[model samples]
Every structure is written in structure tokens, then in C-alpha cells.
Target: MLAHVTVTGRVQGVGFRYSAQQQAAQHNLTGWVQNKADGSVELKVEGPEQKVDRFLEEMKAGFTQFIKVKQIDVDRFNKDEGYKQFSIK
Candidate 1:
């Protein structure tokens, strides 16, 4: 499974990207996280269905203490880009 996630509200310059990378690694997910110019964080994650769901759940539940996730928009699909590892861009 693959998911594109857009997170908003106090997401930039607060170690969100790095935290996300670490979490993704913990879930054994592959993709990347980046800070958008509009102050939102964008990420793509691909892996098993259960792991992806758990990752998203953790994200929505404030996986990192520094991040305050006010909103999350996710688009799920099956297209595989074959990401080898999680990264912060």
C-alpha cells in the first residue's frame, strides 16, 4: 500500500520531518517527508497495510511531542514507487 499524507498546523521547523522519518523507519515503511512552503508537511509512505495504518494512527495521535497535528489529509492508493527507505527532504 501507498499513502500520500498532508499534515497541517505547527508542522514546520519542529523536527516533524526527522521525527516522521524515524517513525516510518520503526514501522519499516519506505517513503519521504518534506516541509512545504505553506508550512504543511507532506509525506508518502509505502509498506504493508497494517503498518501503514498504525503509522497513520500514531501520527494522528501525536507520535512526537513537538508536533501538533491539527489536520491530516491522506490519499491512499496501490501504486508502488518502490521507495527503499524513509527520508527527509
Candidate 2:
């Protein structure tokens, strides 16, 4: 399974991407995370359903002090992006 996630509000320049990468690695997920031009963080993750859900939960709850996720956009992704490991992009 693949999921595209967009996180908004105070998400950049606060180690969110790095923390997300670590969480993804812990979940054994493969994908990428990047900062958007609109001051948001975008993530593309591919893995088992349970792992992906766990990753998302971690992102939501783990960085509560630095990140205020005012909006989250999640969608089913359908593409063979050939990601080997989670990374900050």
C-alpha cells in the first residue's frame, strides 16, 4: 500500500522531516518526505497497511510541541516509485 500525506502548520525547520524519517525506518517503511513551497510537509510512504497507519499516528502525536498539524491530506497512491528506504527529500 502507498499513501501520500500532507501536513500543514509549523511543520518545517523543526526537524519534522528527520523525525518522520526515523519513524518510517522504525516502521520498516520505504518512501520520502519533503517540505512544500507552501510551508507544509509532504510525505509519500509505501508499506503494509498497519505500518503506514502507525507511521501516520506517530507523526501526528510524536512532534506535538514543534508541529501543529492544522491540516492533513491523505490519499491512496498508485505508483511504482521504487523507494528502497525512507528519506528526507
lDDT of 1 by residue, 1-89 (tens): 99999999888878888888889999999999999989999999999989999999989876778879999999999877899999988
Root-mean-square deviation of every model: 0.8, 1.6
What would the TM-score be for candidate 2 when compared with the true structure? 0.89
Each prediction's TM-score versus the true structure:
0.95, 0.89
Cα-lDDT of candidate 1: 0.91
The best candidate by lDDT is 1
| True lDDT of residue 77, candidate 1 | 98
lDDT by residue (43-86, candidate 2, tens digit) is 99999888888888877774657766777789976554779999
